[model samples]
Each structure stands twice: as structure tokens, then as C-alpha cells.
Target: MSSFHIYGHRGSSGTHPENTLLSFQAAHKAGAQGIELDVQLTKDLVPVVIHDERLERTTNGIGFVKDFLYEDLVRLDAGHSFSSRFQGNSIPSLKSVLEWITSNSLMLNIELKNGRFPYDHLETKVLELLTHYHLYDRTIISSFNHYSIQRLTQNGCKVETAILLMEKLVEPWDYLQQVGANSIHIECGAIDEYFITNTHKRGIPVRAFTVNDPYQIAALKKAGCSAIFTDFPLVAMQSI
Candidate 1:
């Protein structure tokens, strides 16, 4: 197996505000090779980097994110909730994140949060932005909504796509073939050495999510995981 990649979950979320540009920058500075973030379409169809459908958890604002326009969403204090030091930091658009990413060599994992509301044209809009930035080669689009994954593949998406799984599936490689996904991004607890080795034999890579414990990180690396998403990129990097 090759060296396992470490991706900051929501950009070093353990120390910084989740999904804000500050967190992303911290992740890069912490020696993370990649960053994983979530994408949700605003009311006007602009793609923004955030993990929740509701705004109260991560921002000073209240209500659903889909109910607000990008102009309004950008004004919210996205960083204050995490710490007073991050006060006045605004929410970042996917375009802004892409612009920042252009200066670095970090691999991007964009997880679409459309399972609840099923935002229209979300797959198309995200693809457009990735194309505009010419980042398809280094980007991986994954979603818990398998329909969205299928849609991207059916529309002939050029970049790699991974199906996000929360539970163990029987013969997941067959499901990957059915969905036209290149890999799997599954919950950490659901994956083991046998699953990773079997999936590797089928030419499918397994990337675990939200892994924080040093022992689990090292174990996954030894198990031949392609990558791991963690809130503490620096700690994860040190583990292996």
C-alpha cells in the first residue's frame, strides 16, 4: 500500500471553525495533504461551503440555509461560534474556496449535502464550479444521496466520484459499479482490514471519515486505506 493521505475534516475543525476559510488555511499549515468540505446551494443557487442544512449550528444566523440568498448568507458570522478570535469571519462561497485552493496542492473532497431537500441542479452547479477552476483532476465529488452520484455519472462527469456510506453494505464493490463511482467514503467504524483488502482487490479505494483517534488512524493506514478524514490533521499526520 502507498502512503495514506490525511484530509482535514471541515478543515481542521477540531481547532478552528468548521468550513470557514480560516479552518482551511489552518489545515494546510498543519501539513494535511487534503481538505474535505461540504457544499450546499443557497436560495439563489450559489454553492457555499457549509456542513449543515440549518444555519444555527455553525453561524449566528437562524433557519435553513436553503432559505437564504448568497448575499445574505455571506454576511453571517461563520467563525464566531467556534471562538471569539474568529469573530467577523463570514461564510465562504465554494468559488472563494476554489480560488484559495488554486494556490495550494491540497486535494479536495466535496460532499454534497442535498439528501434532505434535494436541491435542484446541485450536481450540475458543483460540476460547473469545479470545471471553472480546472480542478477536476484533483477533486473527488461524494454524496450520501446515491441518486446524485448516479446522475453525475450518467451525465458523464469526468472527475472521480465516491459514494458516501454510513453503514456496511454487502459486496460494496458491486454497488460501486452500479453507481459508476470510483471509490468509497464510509464511516470509520464500519470499515475493517478485510473490507479494505477486498475492496482493493476490486480496484476500489476506501477512504474513512471523521477518524480522530491516533490508534485508529495508524490502524487504517496499515490496513491500506487510501485516505482518512479527521478533525485534527496535525495529530493524524503525527500518528502515522
Candidate 2:
């Protein structure tokens, strides 16, 4: 039987701090086949692994992440707020995560967090890094901003593209082709037999996000989901 691919959401975020190297390492150790993480650019235009535009939520820092230089941002503890055990963990660069992905032969979903803060040249910069590590083929670039997805394809990004959506679309397959996306990264609740069947017919896969429940995982697999993003990868791997 074919099983749904299990991707660690924010790198096993349920156990470790989200988007940190430790969290990614934990996810890999937990047997996740792939990992999904968010990336934002600093003031220096250096790509860093982080979820929010602001730093206060996940790190021991103040102000927007884009306001700081790469040198300054690395000093902040990215893990302490989650737990004392990870007090010294710092925000990792995209290079750092790329290295891990390459070394482990893991699939990567690099979500460009450019919806609110459209960092200049973010698409090119991210692509440059992926090319540097020769990981484009193994990577899937996704974004909530359809423009970014469009821009990636425009810039000759050969990496697979997926558009993240939270709301219903009248013609999702049309939109997917318009943006040159090979897959749809969507809210788990929005997926059902009809949605799956329609997209599958077009040769597009559907990946559900942030799913944690065992029953939901099983149902998604039964519905022929291509993969599932979960905070608890070990649990998802075991349940499915």
C-alpha cells in the first residue's frame, strides 16, 4: 500500500522550537521523510529560517526580523522561549538548513514568508542558495503570495512550486496552472474526496498543513493526499 509522505512542520515544532536547527535535527531523527520550514530575509538580505515577521514571538529579541543585520540576529536565542533546554539555540541561516537537507537526503519545503514583507530579490537570493548546494531538484518552494510563486517561475526556478492557500477557490486547478504550481499546499480541513479527486486528475498533488491528529492523518491518506505537514512527525509516521 502507498502511504502518505510525512513532513515535519517547522521541524518537529511540537517538541522543539520552530525553525531552529535543533528542531530540524529532531525532526530528522524522528524519521520524517521531509521537513517544511519558513524563511525570511534580514536587513542584510541574508536568508534566515524563521516563521514570523517579528522576533518577539519566537526569539529573545525585539522588533522585526528584517530590522536586524545577520550578525545581530544570530546573537538572539531562538529556542529559549520554547524551553530552557534550548536556551542557547540561535536562528539558523538558509545555508545551514540546506546543508542539513543535503547531508540527510531529505526533501525540503522552503516556504517564502514574503506576503507581508516582500524582501527585494528574495526569489533570486533563495534560488542562488539552492543552486549553490545543488538542491533544487529535491526542494519544493511554496509561498502564500502567488506573486512570489509567479516570480519564481519567471526567474527560471526549476524547483517544484506549490501555492499555499487557506480559503476556497472557485477554480483551484486553473489558478494552480496560472501560477505554474505542481502542487497545492492547503489547510487540512479544506481537503475532501472531491478536492483530492479533481486535483489528482490534473496530475497535481495536495499537501495538507499542520495536521496532528492520528484520525485526520489516516483520513487524509485514505483520501489520497500526497503528503501531510505535522508538528509531531514521529506520531504521524507511527499512526500512518
Candidate 3:
């Protein structure tokens, strides 16, 4: 149980603005070993750290992330909606985030946001960024889009890849193997003893997402999960 890792979901999102550098720093301060963030491409092809294809929810901007140029995206306030304390937080570029993570000696789980926007060459762009930073050894790239996962594998990325699943599969491990994924990221509701046991049988670990409650964390830990992705990593660290 002590071996389980705590990954900051959207980088301490419960407290700070999700995907902002401040949020990531807060997660690291909370003692999270890894940070999980989403990436989407701007109209000008720059990769930025953000969760949604649409900007309204996360930033004080209108329209889809792909519709905005990189320069314009930078002008939006990503933190104000969260609170006054984080008023000017800007959306971070993947490059910036990578540098921060490298300096802090933290692991990263980059979830490609291509599932919703289908940005052209998103996988390749992300791979290039990881390679530029020499972060493959410490990064796990995941996506709900199995095609994106396959693309990364086919491109010969050595970074660990995981398939994100929101529902139960008849044979989750088999699907993971077929997709060439090294691990699985299952939604908390989809986790069960059967899935965990079979994944462990195959020697691959499972990760749970959006887990915050102490009881839920304890249950997932008891079920032998590899890690828990939490918006409240501070609370998670304290609870465990």
C-alpha cells in the first residue's frame, strides 16, 4: 500500500486553477510524486497545457482552443475564475511545464486532448516536446483515444503509454496489450477486483482518476491500484 503513488490531477486542481503552473507548483508542494495534465494545440500549432477543447470553462476566453492562436491564448486569464488569489495565472506551454517538472524531479502524465479536438499531428508534436526535454524515461503519455495511443506506439516512442478507459471492458488487460499500452488508467467507477487482479496477473499496474475522498483512496489502495489521480493531492498525502 505504501508503494502507491499520488499523482496530482490537473495539478492540485481542487485548490488552484487546473493546468496552471501555480497549480503544478502547489501539487509538488503537497508532496505529489507525479503531475497529470492535459495538452491541446493552439491554432498556430503550439502545444499548451489545458484540459478542455473549449476555453470558456478553464480560461476567461471564448471559443475552442484550436480556434485561437498561441499568442491570443496566452492573453486569457486561466486563474481568475478559480479565485482572486490566482487572478493572473496564464495557461502554460507544454515546454514550460516540462522544464518545471525536470527542475523539480517530478514525473509527468501527459494526457493528449486530441480525443475531443482531433488536432492535426498532436501525438507527433507532443512526442517531439518530450524528446526535446529528454523526458521519455519519466513520462507517461495517455489518451482516451486508442488511436492516439496506437499512433504514439507506432511512432516508436519509448515513453510509457497508458490507455484511458471510462467503462468496463470484457477483457481490459487484453485490450491494453492489443493497443500496446504499458499500463491502464481506469476511471474510479470502473475499477473492480476482477480488473485489478487480471492486470496484476499480467504484471501491468492500474491507475485510478479523480479520487479525492479518503475512504475512496483507502479502498483503491486496498484494491492494489498503482496510483490515484487526485485534484486534492495535499489531502491525499495527509490521508495516506
Give a tens-digit lDDT track for model 1, residues 169-235. 9999999999999999999999976788899988787999989999999999888899999999999
lDDT of 1: 0.94
Best by lDDT: 1
Clashing pairs in 3: none
lDDT value for model 3: 0.91
Q: Tens digits of per-residue lDDT for model 2 on 125-216?
A: 88999999999887999999999999888777799999999966877999988887788999998876778888888878889998999999
Cα-based lDDT for every prediction = 0.94, 0.91, 0.91
Clashes of 1: 0
Give the count of colliding residue pairs in each prediction: 0, 0, 0
After TM-score superposition, what is the CA distance of residue 51 in candidate 1 from its true location, in Å?
0.6
C-alpha-based local distance difference test score of model 2:
0.91
Measured by TM-score, the strongest candidate is: 1
CA displacement after TM-score superposition, residue 127 of candidate 3 (Å): 1.1
How would you encode candidate 3's per-residue C-alpha lDDT over 1-240 as one tens digit per residue? 338989999999999999999999999999998999999998889999999888898889999999889999999999999998889999999999998877878889999988876887788889898988899898999999998898778777799999998999998888887888899998999988888888888889799998999899988988899999999999999887
RMSD of 1: 0.8
Put the candidates in TM-score order, highest first: 1, 2, 3
Better of 1 and 3 by lDDT: 1
